[model samples]
Target: MLLEIEKKIASFIEQVDSSFVQELFAKIQHGKMLRSKLMLAICPKHPDIITLCAIIEMIQIASLLHDDVIDEAHIRRGSPSINAVFGNKNAIMLGDIFYAQAFLKLTSFDRNIAQNVAECVVRLSRGEIHDVVMGNSFQESKERYFSMIEDKTASLIASSAKSAAILANLDSEKYYTYGLNLGIAFQIIDDLLDVFGDEKKLGKPAMSDYAEGKTTLPYLLLYQSLSQADKQKLKSYFRISSMEAKEWISEKMQEKEIFEKTQDMARFFANKALESIEGENNLKLEEIIKNMIYREF
Candidate 1:
Protein backbone atom coordinates (compact mmCIF):
# COMPACT_ATOMS: atom_id res chain seq x y z
CA MET A 1 0.00 0.00 0.00
CA LEU A 2 2.77 2.40 0.97
CA LEU A 3 4.76 1.46 -2.15
CA GLU A 4 1.86 2.42 -4.36
CA ILE A 5 1.52 5.69 -2.50
CA GLU A 6 5.23 6.37 -3.05
CA LYS A 7 4.87 5.60 -6.74
CA LYS A 8 1.96 8.02 -7.04
CA ILE A 9 3.98 10.70 -5.24
CA ALA A 10 6.89 10.15 -7.60
CA SER A 11 4.64 10.30 -10.66
CA PHE A 12 3.07 13.52 -9.51
CA ILE A 13 6.41 15.21 -8.82
CA GLU A 14 7.91 13.96 -12.07
CA GLN A 15 5.74 16.47 -13.91
CA VAL A 16 7.45 19.33 -12.08
CA ASP A 17 10.26 21.07 -13.98
CA SER A 18 12.98 21.06 -11.34
CA SER A 19 15.50 18.23 -11.31
CA PHE A 20 16.23 19.17 -7.71
CA VAL A 21 12.67 18.29 -6.75
CA GLN A 22 13.11 14.90 -8.37
CA GLU A 23 16.36 14.35 -6.55
CA LEU A 24 14.77 15.33 -3.27
CA PHE A 25 11.92 12.87 -3.78
CA ALA A 26 14.32 10.17 -4.82
CA LYS A 27 16.27 10.50 -1.59
CA ILE A 28 13.24 10.38 0.70
CA GLN A 29 13.08 7.14 2.76
CA HIS A 30 9.37 7.31 3.62
CA GLY A 31 10.12 6.01 7.08
CA LYS A 32 7.45 3.64 8.48
CA MET A 33 4.43 5.52 6.96
CA LEU A 34 2.90 5.14 10.42
CA ARG A 35 0.16 7.71 9.81
CA SER A 36 -1.03 5.96 6.70
CA LYS A 37 -0.86 2.62 8.44
CA LEU A 38 -2.99 3.94 11.29
CA MET A 39 -5.58 5.25 8.85
CA LEU A 40 -5.67 1.98 6.94
CA ALA A 41 -6.11 0.01 10.12
CA ILE A 42 -9.32 1.92 10.82
CA CYS A 43 -10.82 2.08 7.32
CA PRO A 44 -9.02 -0.43 5.17
CA LYS A 45 -12.00 -0.86 2.89
CA HIS A 46 -12.62 2.82 2.21
CA PRO A 47 -12.28 3.39 -1.52
CA ASP A 48 -10.37 6.61 -1.05
CA ILE A 49 -7.96 5.30 1.59
CA ILE A 50 -5.01 5.27 -0.80
CA THR A 51 -5.56 8.87 -1.89
CA LEU A 52 -6.07 9.97 1.69
CA CYS A 53 -2.83 8.30 2.72
CA ALA A 54 -1.03 10.00 -0.14
CA ILE A 55 -2.35 13.37 0.97
CA ILE A 56 -1.23 12.73 4.55
CA GLU A 57 2.24 11.72 3.39
CA MET A 58 2.55 14.82 1.22
CA ILE A 59 1.52 17.10 4.04
CA GLN A 60 4.11 15.51 6.34
CA ILE A 61 6.84 15.91 3.74
CA ALA A 62 5.89 19.50 3.03
CA SER A 63 6.01 20.37 6.73
CA LEU A 64 9.44 18.74 7.17
CA LEU A 65 10.83 20.62 4.17
CA HIS A 66 9.70 23.95 5.58
CA ASP A 67 10.88 22.98 9.07
CA ASP A 68 14.38 22.25 7.82
CA VAL A 69 14.50 25.68 6.21
CA ILE A 70 13.40 27.27 9.47
CA ASP A 71 15.95 25.33 11.52
CA GLU A 72 18.67 25.96 8.91
CA ALA A 73 19.28 22.25 9.30
CA HIS A 74 21.93 20.67 7.13
CA ILE A 75 21.03 17.01 7.65
CA ARG A 76 17.81 14.96 7.60
CA ARG A 77 17.18 11.21 7.60
CA GLY A 78 20.94 10.51 7.37
CA SER A 79 21.55 12.70 4.34
CA PRO A 80 21.98 16.33 3.35
CA SER A 81 18.64 18.10 3.66
CA ILE A 82 16.88 19.52 0.58
CA ASN A 83 17.56 23.07 1.77
CA ALA A 84 21.20 22.17 2.38
CA VAL A 85 21.57 21.00 -1.21
CA PHE A 86 19.26 23.22 -3.27
CA GLY A 87 19.11 26.26 -0.96
CA ASN A 88 16.36 27.49 1.37
CA LYS A 89 14.44 29.46 -1.24
CA ASN A 90 13.96 26.43 -3.45
CA ALA A 91 13.19 24.21 -0.47
CA ILE A 92 10.46 26.58 0.74
CA MET A 93 8.96 26.81 -2.74
CA LEU A 94 8.99 23.06 -3.08
CA GLY A 95 7.24 22.71 0.25
CA ASP A 96 4.54 25.08 -1.00
CA ILE A 97 4.23 23.04 -4.16
CA PHE A 98 3.67 19.89 -2.13
CA TYR A 99 1.02 21.61 -0.02
CA ALA A 100 -0.74 22.77 -3.19
CA GLN A 101 -0.66 19.27 -4.64
CA ALA A 102 -1.99 17.73 -1.45
CA PHE A 103 -4.94 20.13 -1.20
CA LEU A 104 -5.70 19.70 -4.88
CA LYS A 105 -5.86 15.94 -4.46
CA LEU A 106 -7.95 16.29 -1.31
CA THR A 107 -10.59 18.30 -3.19
CA SER A 108 -11.95 15.07 -4.63
CA PHE A 109 -12.94 14.02 -1.10
CA ASP A 110 -15.46 15.57 1.29
CA ARG A 111 -15.16 19.30 1.95
CA ASN A 112 -14.75 18.61 5.67
CA ILE A 113 -11.48 16.76 5.05
CA ALA A 114 -10.07 19.66 3.07
CA GLN A 115 -11.13 22.09 5.78
CA ASN A 116 -9.52 19.99 8.48
CA VAL A 117 -6.31 19.76 6.48
CA ALA A 118 -6.24 23.53 6.02
CA GLU A 119 -6.90 24.08 9.71
CA CYS A 120 -4.15 21.64 10.60
CA VAL A 121 -1.70 23.57 8.44
CA VAL A 122 -2.69 26.81 10.12
CA ARG A 123 -2.08 25.29 13.57
CA LEU A 124 1.22 23.87 12.38
CA SER A 125 2.32 27.30 11.17
CA ARG A 126 1.38 28.81 14.50
CA GLY A 127 3.37 26.17 16.33
CA GLU A 128 6.39 26.86 14.16
CA ILE A 129 6.10 30.55 14.98
CA HIS A 130 5.97 29.75 18.68
CA ASP A 131 9.05 27.57 18.41
CA VAL A 132 10.92 30.35 16.63
CA VAL A 133 9.96 32.92 19.25
CA MET A 134 11.04 30.58 22.04
CA GLY A 135 14.34 29.59 20.49
CA ASN A 136 17.39 29.68 22.78
CA SER A 137 15.13 30.86 25.62
CA PHE A 138 15.07 28.81 28.82
CA GLN A 139 12.02 30.66 30.08
CA GLU A 140 9.57 28.38 28.18
CA SER A 141 7.05 26.63 30.41
CA LYS A 142 6.45 22.89 30.06
CA GLU A 143 2.77 23.53 29.38
CA ARG A 144 3.61 25.84 26.49
CA TYR A 145 6.15 23.40 25.11
CA PHE A 146 3.62 20.53 25.01
CA SER A 147 1.03 22.81 23.44
CA MET A 148 3.49 23.79 20.76
CA ILE A 149 4.33 20.18 19.96
CA GLU A 150 0.66 19.13 19.90
CA ASP A 151 -0.09 21.78 17.30
CA LYS A 152 3.17 21.34 15.39
CA THR A 153 3.27 17.55 15.30
CA ALA A 154 0.10 15.89 16.56
CA SER A 155 -2.61 17.93 14.85
CA LEU A 156 -1.94 16.52 11.40
CA ILE A 157 -1.71 12.97 12.69
CA ALA A 158 -4.93 13.31 14.62
CA SER A 159 -6.70 14.85 11.64
CA SER A 160 -5.46 12.19 9.28
CA ALA A 161 -6.85 9.40 11.44
CA LYS A 162 -10.09 11.25 12.11
CA SER A 163 -10.48 11.92 8.39
CA ALA A 164 -10.20 8.23 7.76
CA ALA A 165 -12.89 7.54 10.36
CA ILE A 166 -15.09 10.16 8.74
CA LEU A 167 -14.72 8.43 5.39
CA ALA A 168 -15.79 5.13 6.97
CA ASN A 169 -18.68 6.67 8.88
CA LEU A 170 -17.16 5.44 12.16
CA ASP A 171 -16.41 7.10 15.51
CA SER A 172 -14.01 9.83 14.49
CA GLU A 173 -13.47 11.05 18.05
CA LYS A 174 -11.97 7.76 19.22
CA TYR A 175 -9.48 7.62 16.39
CA TYR A 176 -8.68 11.29 16.92
CA THR A 177 -7.72 10.54 20.51
CA TYR A 178 -5.63 7.60 19.40
CA GLY A 179 -3.78 9.67 16.84
CA LEU A 180 -3.32 12.54 19.24
CA ASN A 181 -1.73 10.43 21.93
CA LEU A 182 0.36 8.56 19.40
CA GLY A 183 1.68 11.81 17.95
CA ILE A 184 2.57 13.22 21.36
CA ALA A 185 4.42 10.04 22.27
CA PHE A 186 6.11 10.07 18.89
CA GLN A 187 7.36 13.64 19.38
CA ILE A 188 8.55 12.96 22.92
CA ILE A 189 10.56 9.98 21.72
CA ASP A 190 11.95 12.11 18.93
CA ASP A 191 13.09 14.62 21.55
CA LEU A 192 14.76 11.82 23.50
CA LEU A 193 16.47 10.59 20.34
CA ASP A 194 17.80 14.07 19.61
CA VAL A 195 19.67 13.82 22.90
CA PHE A 196 20.71 10.16 23.08
CA GLY A 197 20.25 8.65 19.61
CA ASP A 198 23.09 7.64 17.29
CA GLU A 199 24.02 10.38 14.84
CA LYS A 200 24.72 7.88 12.05
CA LYS A 201 21.39 6.16 12.51
CA LEU A 202 19.44 9.40 13.01
CA GLY A 203 21.21 10.95 10.02
CA LYS A 204 21.60 14.13 12.06
CA PRO A 205 23.69 15.41 14.92
CA ALA A 206 22.79 14.17 18.37
CA MET A 207 22.16 16.72 21.16
CA SER A 208 20.77 18.95 18.39
CA ASP A 209 17.94 20.09 20.66
CA TYR A 210 20.47 21.42 23.18
CA ALA A 211 22.63 22.93 20.44
CA GLU A 212 19.61 24.68 18.99
CA GLY A 213 18.69 25.93 22.48
CA LYS A 214 15.38 24.15 22.42
CA THR A 215 14.48 23.19 26.00
CA THR A 216 12.96 19.74 25.50
CA LEU A 217 11.45 17.63 28.30
CA PRO A 218 14.72 16.05 29.39
CA TYR A 219 16.41 19.39 29.91
CA LEU A 220 13.31 20.82 31.54
CA LEU A 221 13.14 17.96 34.06
CA LEU A 222 16.85 18.09 34.77
CA TYR A 223 16.78 21.88 35.24
CA GLN A 224 14.38 21.61 38.18
CA SER A 225 16.85 19.45 40.15
CA LEU A 226 19.99 21.47 39.41
CA SER A 227 21.78 23.85 41.75
CA GLN A 228 21.69 27.53 40.78
CA ALA A 229 25.29 27.43 39.60
CA ASP A 230 24.71 24.23 37.63
CA LYS A 231 21.60 25.70 36.08
CA GLN A 232 23.61 28.73 35.00
CA LYS A 233 26.33 26.46 33.66
CA LEU A 234 23.76 24.57 31.61
CA LYS A 235 22.29 27.81 30.29
CA SER A 236 25.76 29.04 29.37
CA TYR A 237 26.50 25.88 27.42
CA PHE A 238 23.61 26.64 25.07
CA ARG A 239 25.71 29.42 23.50
CA ILE A 240 28.84 27.31 23.21
CA SER A 241 29.24 25.07 20.14
CA SER A 242 31.91 22.83 21.52
CA MET A 243 31.43 19.03 21.58
CA GLU A 244 32.64 19.17 25.17
CA ALA A 245 29.61 21.21 26.14
CA LYS A 246 27.28 18.64 24.54
CA GLU A 247 29.10 15.83 26.28
CA TRP A 248 28.93 17.61 29.61
CA ILE A 249 25.18 18.10 29.24
CA SER A 250 24.72 14.51 28.13
CA GLU A 251 26.71 13.22 31.10
CA LYS A 252 24.71 15.36 33.51
CA MET A 253 21.41 14.20 32.00
CA GLN A 254 22.55 10.59 32.42
CA GLU A 255 23.69 11.21 35.97
CA LYS A 256 20.30 12.66 36.78
CA GLU A 257 18.41 9.87 34.91
CA ILE A 258 16.67 12.46 32.77
CA PHE A 259 16.54 10.14 29.75
CA GLU A 260 14.69 7.44 31.72
CA LYS A 261 12.21 9.99 33.01
CA THR A 262 11.61 11.30 29.50
CA GLN A 263 10.97 7.78 28.24
CA ASP A 264 8.48 7.24 31.05
CA MET A 265 6.57 10.28 29.87
CA ALA A 266 6.55 8.94 26.33
CA ARG A 267 5.31 5.57 27.59
CA PHE A 268 2.45 7.26 29.41
CA PHE A 269 1.20 8.79 26.17
CA ALA A 270 1.76 5.57 24.25
CA ASN A 271 -0.45 3.77 26.74
CA LYS A 272 -3.12 6.41 26.33
CA ALA A 273 -3.10 5.83 22.59
CA LEU A 274 -3.52 2.11 23.12
CA GLU A 275 -6.37 2.63 25.56
CA SER A 276 -8.17 4.78 23.01
CA ILE A 277 -8.30 1.81 20.69
CA GLU A 278 -9.14 -0.79 23.28
CA GLY A 279 -11.36 -3.66 22.06
CA GLU A 280 -10.87 -2.63 18.46
CA ASN A 281 -9.16 -5.73 17.02
CA ASN A 282 -6.40 -3.71 15.45
CA LEU A 283 -3.46 -5.62 16.83
CA LYS A 284 -1.16 -4.34 14.12
CA LEU A 285 -1.63 -0.71 15.12
CA GLU A 286 -1.26 -1.62 18.79
CA GLU A 287 2.09 -3.24 18.11
CA ILE A 288 3.23 -0.31 15.99
CA ILE A 289 2.46 2.18 18.75
CA LYS A 290 4.38 0.10 21.28
CA ASN A 291 7.39 -0.20 18.99
CA MET A 292 7.33 3.48 18.07
CA ILE A 293 7.73 4.69 21.65
CA TYR A 294 10.25 2.01 22.56
CA ARG A 295 12.31 2.33 19.39
CA GLU A 296 16.04 2.91 19.96
CA PHE A 297 16.58 5.14 16.94
Candidate 2:
Protein backbone atom coordinates (compact mmCIF):
# COMPACT_ATOMS: atom_id res chain seq x y z
CA MET A 1 0.00 0.00 0.00
CA LEU A 2 2.77 2.42 0.95
CA LEU A 3 4.64 1.29 -2.18
CA GLU A 4 1.79 2.51 -4.34
CA ILE A 5 1.86 5.85 -2.60
CA GLU A 6 5.63 6.05 -3.19
CA LYS A 7 5.18 5.26 -6.86
CA LYS A 8 2.55 7.95 -7.09
CA ILE A 9 4.90 10.48 -5.47
CA ALA A 10 7.67 9.50 -7.84
CA SER A 11 5.37 10.01 -10.80
CA PHE A 12 4.58 13.53 -9.67
CA ILE A 13 8.25 14.28 -9.00
CA GLU A 14 9.16 13.01 -12.45
CA GLN A 15 6.81 15.54 -14.03
CA VAL A 16 8.81 18.47 -12.63
CA ASP A 17 11.45 19.63 -15.09
CA SER A 18 14.02 20.70 -12.47
CA SER A 19 16.73 18.24 -11.57
CA PHE A 20 17.57 20.27 -8.49
CA VAL A 21 14.08 19.86 -7.16
CA GLN A 22 14.18 16.15 -7.91
CA GLU A 23 17.54 15.78 -6.24
CA LEU A 24 16.41 17.81 -3.25
CA PHE A 25 13.45 15.49 -2.89
CA ALA A 26 15.82 12.58 -2.81
CA LYS A 27 17.75 14.14 0.07
CA ILE A 28 14.82 14.68 2.43
CA GLN A 29 13.61 11.80 4.57
CA HIS A 30 9.95 10.79 4.48
CA GLY A 31 7.89 10.45 7.64
CA LYS A 32 5.30 7.76 8.40
CA MET A 33 2.96 9.39 5.83
CA LEU A 34 0.27 9.47 8.50
CA ARG A 35 -1.91 11.81 6.45
CA SER A 36 -1.64 9.59 3.38
CA LYS A 37 -2.33 6.54 5.50
CA LEU A 38 -5.49 8.12 6.87
CA MET A 39 -6.72 8.88 3.35
CA LEU A 40 -5.90 5.37 2.12
CA ALA A 41 -7.61 3.80 5.11
CA ILE A 42 -10.79 5.67 4.26
CA CYS A 43 -10.91 4.92 0.54
CA PRO A 44 -8.51 2.04 0.18
CA LYS A 45 -9.75 0.57 -3.10
CA HIS A 46 -10.71 3.79 -4.82
CA PRO A 47 -8.85 4.18 -8.09
CA ASP A 48 -7.87 7.73 -7.25
CA ILE A 49 -6.84 6.96 -3.68
CA ILE A 50 -3.16 6.72 -4.51
CA THR A 51 -3.20 10.00 -6.37
CA LEU A 52 -5.00 11.71 -3.52
CA CYS A 53 -2.50 10.40 -1.01
CA ALA A 54 0.35 11.61 -3.20
CA ILE A 55 -1.10 15.09 -3.47
CA ILE A 56 -1.58 15.41 0.30
CA GLU A 57 1.94 14.11 0.89
CA MET A 58 3.25 16.91 -1.33
CA ILE A 59 1.38 19.48 0.72
CA GLN A 60 2.62 17.88 3.95
CA ILE A 61 6.24 18.06 2.81
CA ALA A 62 5.83 21.61 1.62
CA SER A 63 4.46 22.65 5.00
CA LEU A 64 7.30 20.87 6.81
CA LEU A 65 9.90 22.63 4.68
CA HIS A 66 8.47 25.98 5.68
CA ASP A 67 8.13 24.79 9.30
CA ASP A 68 11.77 23.76 9.53
CA VAL A 69 12.82 27.11 8.16
CA ILE A 70 10.60 28.90 10.66
CA ASP A 71 11.77 26.88 13.66
CA GLU A 72 15.36 26.82 12.35
CA ALA A 73 15.06 23.06 12.59
CA HIS A 74 18.26 21.30 11.59
CA ILE A 75 16.92 17.77 11.62
CA ARG A 76 13.75 16.15 10.30
CA ARG A 77 12.60 12.56 10.76
CA GLY A 78 16.05 11.75 12.18
CA SER A 79 17.94 13.21 9.17
CA PRO A 80 19.51 16.54 8.32
CA SER A 81 16.78 18.82 6.98
CA ILE A 82 16.86 20.43 3.56
CA ASN A 83 17.52 23.86 5.03
CA ALA A 84 20.28 22.43 7.22
CA VAL A 85 22.14 20.86 4.30
CA PHE A 86 21.18 22.69 1.10
CA GLY A 87 20.36 26.17 2.41
CA ASN A 88 17.07 27.91 3.16
CA LYS A 89 16.63 29.16 -0.41
CA ASN A 90 16.69 25.66 -1.86
CA ALA A 91 14.45 24.31 0.89
CA ILE A 92 11.84 27.05 0.44
CA MET A 93 11.91 26.81 -3.35
CA LEU A 94 11.64 23.04 -3.28
CA GLY A 95 8.66 23.42 -1.01
CA ASP A 96 7.09 25.77 -3.53
CA ILE A 97 7.60 23.20 -6.25
CA PHE A 98 5.78 20.60 -4.21
CA TYR A 99 2.89 22.93 -3.38
CA ALA A 100 2.59 24.00 -7.01
CA GLN A 101 2.59 20.40 -8.16
CA ALA A 102 0.01 19.46 -5.56
CA PHE A 103 -2.25 22.33 -6.53
CA LEU A 104 -1.88 21.54 -10.20
CA LYS A 105 -3.09 18.03 -9.54
CA LEU A 106 -5.92 19.28 -7.35
CA THR A 107 -7.44 21.01 -10.37
CA SER A 108 -8.09 17.58 -11.84
CA PHE A 109 -10.17 16.46 -8.87
CA ASP A 110 -13.75 17.26 -7.90
CA ARG A 111 -14.12 20.95 -7.11
CA ASN A 112 -15.25 20.24 -3.56
CA ILE A 113 -12.28 18.02 -2.93
CA ALA A 114 -9.91 20.56 -4.43
CA GLN A 115 -11.37 23.44 -2.48
CA ASN A 116 -11.47 21.53 0.78
CA VAL A 117 -7.81 20.67 0.52
CA ALA A 118 -6.85 24.20 -0.55
CA GLU A 119 -8.48 25.77 2.50
CA CYS A 120 -6.46 23.54 4.75
CA VAL A 121 -3.31 25.05 3.24
CA VAL A 122 -4.53 28.49 4.20
CA ARG A 123 -5.14 27.33 7.77
CA LEU A 124 -1.79 25.59 7.83
CA SER A 125 -0.03 28.85 7.00
CA ARG A 126 -2.14 30.74 9.49
CA GLY A 127 -1.30 28.17 12.12
CA GLU A 128 2.37 28.64 11.34
CA ILE A 129 2.01 32.36 11.90
CA HIS A 130 0.25 31.83 15.22
CA ASP A 131 2.98 29.44 16.30
CA VAL A 132 5.70 31.99 15.55
CA VAL A 133 3.89 34.70 17.46
CA MET A 134 3.21 32.43 20.41
CA GLY A 135 6.85 31.35 20.54
CA ASN A 136 7.97 34.92 21.04
CA SER A 137 7.09 34.57 24.73
CA PHE A 138 5.99 32.00 27.23
CA GLN A 139 2.29 31.24 26.70
CA GLU A 140 -0.06 29.44 29.07
CA SER A 141 -3.39 29.76 27.31
CA LYS A 142 -4.83 26.35 26.57
CA GLU A 143 -7.35 27.83 24.19
CA ARG A 144 -4.70 29.46 22.02
CA TYR A 145 -2.50 26.37 21.98
CA PHE A 146 -5.31 24.07 20.88
CA SER A 147 -6.39 26.50 18.19
CA MET A 148 -2.86 26.79 16.87
CA ILE A 149 -2.34 23.05 16.65
CA GLU A 150 -5.70 22.61 14.94
CA ASP A 151 -4.70 25.03 12.24
CA LYS A 152 -1.10 23.89 11.84
CA THR A 153 -1.41 20.13 12.18
CA ALA A 154 -4.98 18.87 12.50
CA SER A 155 -6.40 20.81 9.56
CA LEU A 156 -4.56 18.83 6.91
CA ILE A 157 -5.17 15.50 8.56
CA ALA A 158 -8.88 16.27 8.87
CA SER A 159 -9.03 17.40 5.29
CA SER A 160 -7.33 14.22 4.16
CA ALA A 161 -10.05 12.04 5.65
CA LYS A 162 -12.80 14.45 4.69
CA SER A 163 -11.68 14.58 1.08
CA ALA A 164 -11.40 10.81 0.93
CA ALA A 165 -14.92 10.48 2.22
CA ILE A 166 -16.10 12.93 -0.41
CA LEU A 167 -14.47 10.84 -3.12
CA ALA A 168 -15.62 7.49 -1.73
CA ASN A 169 -19.25 8.53 -1.24
CA LEU A 170 -18.92 7.84 2.46
CA ASP A 171 -20.04 10.04 5.37
CA SER A 172 -17.67 12.94 5.02
CA GLU A 173 -18.69 14.61 8.26
CA LYS A 174 -17.97 11.58 10.41
CA TYR A 175 -14.52 11.11 9.00
CA TYR A 176 -13.84 14.81 9.27
CA THR A 177 -14.71 14.71 12.94
CA TYR A 178 -12.55 11.66 13.42
CA GLY A 179 -9.68 13.29 11.55
CA LEU A 180 -9.95 16.48 13.60
CA ASN A 181 -9.80 14.55 16.86
CA LEU A 182 -6.94 12.44 15.62
CA GLY A 183 -5.02 15.48 14.41
CA ILE A 184 -5.40 17.31 17.73
CA ALA A 185 -4.51 14.17 19.62
CA PHE A 186 -1.53 13.72 17.34
CA GLN A 187 -0.26 17.19 18.25
CA ILE A 188 -0.80 16.57 21.96
CA ILE A 189 1.17 13.36 21.78
CA ASP A 190 3.91 15.20 19.91
CA ASP A 191 3.96 17.81 22.69
CA LEU A 192 4.27 15.05 25.27
CA LEU A 193 7.00 13.36 23.29
CA ASP A 194 9.02 16.54 23.06
CA VAL A 195 9.44 16.51 26.83
CA PHE A 196 9.30 12.78 27.54
CA GLY A 197 10.93 11.21 24.49
CA ASP A 198 14.55 10.09 24.49
CA GLU A 199 16.60 12.80 22.85
CA LYS A 200 18.88 10.30 21.10
CA LYS A 201 15.98 8.25 19.76
CA LEU A 202 13.96 11.35 18.76
CA GLY A 203 16.96 12.92 17.05
CA LYS A 204 16.18 16.12 18.94
CA PRO A 205 16.65 17.40 22.44
CA ALA A 206 14.06 16.61 25.05
CA MET A 207 12.28 19.78 26.24
CA SER A 208 13.29 21.35 22.96
CA ASP A 209 9.91 23.05 22.66
CA TYR A 210 10.06 24.64 26.10
CA ALA A 211 13.70 25.56 25.65
CA GLU A 212 12.75 27.26 22.41
CA GLY A 213 10.23 29.46 24.32
CA LYS A 214 7.05 27.73 23.31
CA THR A 215 5.30 26.53 26.47
CA THR A 216 3.94 23.11 25.58
CA LEU A 217 0.94 21.45 27.28
CA PRO A 218 2.98 19.57 29.83
CA TYR A 219 4.79 22.74 30.86
CA LEU A 220 1.57 24.74 30.92
CA LEU A 221 -0.24 22.18 32.99
CA LEU A 222 2.73 21.78 35.21
CA TYR A 223 2.96 25.55 35.50
CA GLN A 224 -0.64 25.78 36.66
CA SER A 225 0.07 23.26 39.38
CA LEU A 226 3.07 25.19 40.70
CA SER A 227 3.15 27.89 43.40
CA GLN A 228 3.85 31.54 42.55
CA ALA A 229 7.55 31.25 43.26
CA ASP A 230 7.80 27.98 41.40
CA LYS A 231 5.94 29.45 38.42
CA GLN A 232 8.36 32.34 38.33
CA LYS A 233 11.22 29.91 38.48
CA LEU A 234 9.86 27.87 35.57
CA LYS A 235 9.29 31.00 33.53
CA SER A 236 12.85 32.13 34.25
CA TYR A 237 14.07 28.78 32.99
CA PHE A 238 12.52 29.41 29.59
CA ARG A 239 15.03 28.79 26.79
CA ILE A 240 17.60 27.93 29.46
CA SER A 241 19.17 24.52 29.00
CA SER A 242 21.30 23.32 31.86
CA MET A 243 21.61 20.20 33.95
CA GLU A 244 20.02 21.98 36.89
CA ALA A 245 16.99 23.07 34.89
CA LYS A 246 16.58 19.59 33.46
CA GLU A 247 16.85 18.10 36.91
CA TRP A 248 14.30 20.55 38.29
CA ILE A 249 11.84 19.70 35.51
CA SER A 250 12.45 16.00 36.00
CA GLU A 251 11.72 16.23 39.72
CA LYS A 252 8.54 18.25 39.10
CA MET A 253 7.30 15.76 36.46
CA GLN A 254 7.85 12.93 38.92
CA GLU A 255 6.09 14.75 41.72
CA LYS A 256 3.10 16.33 39.92
CA GLU A 257 1.22 13.64 37.98
CA ILE A 258 1.32 16.16 35.11
CA PHE A 259 2.30 13.55 32.57
CA GLU A 260 -0.75 11.48 33.40
CA LYS A 261 -3.02 14.50 33.03
CA THR A 262 -1.52 15.26 29.65
CA GLN A 263 -1.94 11.65 28.64
CA ASP A 264 -5.56 11.72 29.79
CA MET A 265 -6.18 14.77 27.61
CA ALA A 266 -4.71 12.99 24.61
CA ARG A 267 -6.79 9.94 25.45
CA PHE A 268 -9.89 12.12 25.59
CA PHE A 269 -9.38 13.13 22.00
CA ALA A 270 -8.49 9.59 21.00
CA ASN A 271 -11.73 8.38 22.47
CA LYS A 272 -13.59 11.11 20.61
CA ALA A 273 -12.01 9.87 17.41
CA LEU A 274 -13.19 6.36 18.15
CA GLU A 275 -16.66 7.55 19.06
CA SER A 276 -16.92 9.51 15.84
CA ILE A 277 -16.44 6.34 13.86
CA GLU A 278 -18.36 3.99 16.12
CA GLY A 279 -20.31 1.98 13.56
CA GLU A 280 -17.61 1.98 10.90
CA ASN A 281 -15.98 -1.16 12.32
CA ASN A 282 -12.77 -0.20 10.60
CA LEU A 283 -10.05 -1.74 12.74
CA LYS A 284 -7.31 -0.02 10.78
CA LEU A 285 -8.72 3.37 11.65
CA GLU A 286 -9.03 2.40 15.30
CA GLU A 287 -5.45 1.23 15.31
CA ILE A 288 -4.33 4.51 13.77
CA ILE A 289 -5.85 6.47 16.63
CA LYS A 290 -4.59 4.06 19.29
CA ASN A 291 -1.05 4.02 17.92
CA MET A 292 -1.03 7.77 17.60
CA ILE A 293 -2.08 8.52 21.19
CA TYR A 294 -0.09 5.75 22.85
CA ARG A 295 3.18 5.55 20.93
CA GLU A 296 6.52 6.15 22.68
CA PHE A 297 8.95 8.31 20.78
Summed backbone clashes in each candidate are 1, 0
TM-score of each: 0.94, 0.97
Each model's C-alpha lDDT? Answer: 0.85, 0.90
Worst 10 residues of 2 by lDDT: 288-297
**Per-residue accuracy of model 1 over 1-297 as CA lDDT, tens digit each:** 889878878776776767877876776667778888888888888778888888889989998999999888988777788888888998898889888888888888898878877888898889888888878577437898899889999888899888988998888888899988999999999999988888888787788877776888888888877889999988887745688888888889989999889999999999998899888778877987978976875
User: Following a full C-alpha superposition, what root-mean-square deviation does model 2 have from the true structure?
Assistant: 1.1
TM-score of 1: 0.94
| lDDT, candidate 2, 113-162, per-residue tens | 99999999999999999999999888879999999999999999999999
After superposition on all CA atoms, what RMSD does each candidate show versus the true structure?
1.7, 1.1
In model 1, residue pairs whose N, Cα or C atoms come closer than 3 Å (at least 3 residues apart or on different chains), thus clashing, are: 78-203
